[model samples]
Target: MTDFVDNVAFIGLGAMGYAMAKNIRKKMAPTGTLYVFDVFGRVCEKFRDEFKSFGPIVIVESPKEAAAMSQTIISIVPGAKEVRDVYLNNNSGVIVAPKNEDRLIMECSTIDSQSSREVGQALGTAGTGKYIDTPVSTRMQGGVPGADSGTLSFLIGHSKPSDTDPISHRLEKVATMMGNPKKFFYCGKLGAGLAAKISNNYLSCSILLAVAEAMAIGIRSGVDEKLLHEVIQNSTGQNFMADVVQPVPGVVPDAPSSNNYRLGFKTQMMIKDLGLGVDAGYATGIKPTMAEAAYRVYENAAVDPKCIDRDGSSVYLHITTTQEDHQE
Candidate 1:
């Protein structure tokens, strides 16, 4: 009631959004309620049941309804198209909703930096709600487990619409509940968060592709897969995808590959994120060699019936399998 921006609504209940929303509810529930809304009502329904221990998880019908009811809105949908639909679409989106100068509209999706800037422009033109792009980093392999533990680092970016806004002051407090408050970094200026996130993800996806291909080559060259992994992990070539989510099975006991690469960041999503990075490069007149190459790798694997739904680590299998097919 007395805290800054007591009412909060989360428009997307996907992995990160759900975790962040749960944390916000746990922290802000006593003072106010956390409103949950998604294009898919089932996600909100399931989230409502899961957050019983926390204060009320109020569900709403649409994004516009969510904005109307809450002082702060956090949306973490997939890409730029979805972002535009949620914030800029006039018929059903939040941009046309009744003016509320006190509200904060935050987009947490990893989209092109230009889209973030345009969305901020739309918000300013609408004359209601300050907008910010708060894209999170791709180092977030924590999945829902980390959300359950409440330890995700967030990056905040201030757009032109948020130039003079004090929404971040409220965020400084609310962000601590979402993850390590100390890890929160303000990138400054609109789309900076998206740019930063895309940059981080570009490294992640590109390294994943490069490492997977390298692993496939090592395996084909008669190098023991797990042994190579251990050597690399102990050597200077180690990384999260190599050491933690090692694409090779039995290399890392907890890696997705150990369990058939069933559940983690999907191959399709990785391709999508990589494409965003590629777009960023195009916008800046720079060639995204690694990112584009990685995108092509993932794109090839994504269409494979086997790799379509598998974890991004499955790119290892994709590479090895393609090489096998080529040899025959």
Candidate 2:
């Protein structure tokens, strides 16, 4: 691979984006220039000030400016539409056509495979820059400590194997700066990363829903929620959900689930991802009953003010509370 580039531009400074950008600033030593842009002026200014001590923090007006100023452009926008608007929409005057063939564009949004392919095609045809779909699997909290430790797992979709090597190496450095770089898989093709992210998240959401249902049943049957969680933890269900955060209340006392579900992964975001998963499944004519059901539950919860304030783990509270309130 070629020598790692120093200057980088980051678009979208949302919770996760801000953390990733901050980690990049910390790890890329000699302190390379970092240009950032977001719809919120305050976020841009905040990050600019926070990272100013580390290196040069340029606050730009738009995505195009950020793309134009750096050798590599990274996007961590919310959804497929935002990703398209920031990178591919020519009408917005924010499309950053690459200055040379060496430039790289990495998108870390969790969207669908189709959207990823379309965006990748457009960016690739722009001729100067190569695009890579590198959606992350870690949670928002993971962003803070995860960035510095380089423990975030990345599933990458690249135009070609050769085009990916340098970007992967650079991202590993960036990931480790944030936390510990665990797994970086080159999944192949332009949309593979998006597909992998959605598939993984669908399972996560499903498991959380299952855990919520199980806990609700146990609580209704006079079984303690903590005991049920312990059994599940010792069982095969002890994946990320059991180890990191449980969806049921009283399972993990320190988890967001026990704290009324405030500030983790928002229910609105989970609903959006479930929608994407449903759409993907429908397109393939595969029945995703569990995923579709979970999507509806999150969708219903998103409208509730309490659930809206909490993370996806709050689904357990919704199930348990509703069941208790409705019980005879």
Return the top candidate by lDDT: 1
Question: How do all models score by TM-score?
Answer: 0.90, 0.89
Angstrom error at residue 284, model 1: 0.7
Off by over 4 Å in 1: 1-5, 159-165, 234-236
lDDT of 1 at 191: 81
Q: Which stretches of candidate 2 lie over 4 Å from their true place?
A: 1-4, 91-98, 140-150, 159-168, 236-239
lDDT of model 2, residue 103: 67
Task: Report the C-alpha lDDT of model 1 over 179-233, residue by residue, as the tens digit.
Answer: 6766677888788877887888888888888788778778878999888987888
**Residue pairs in candidate 1 whose N, alpha carbon or C atoms collide under 3 angstroms:** none
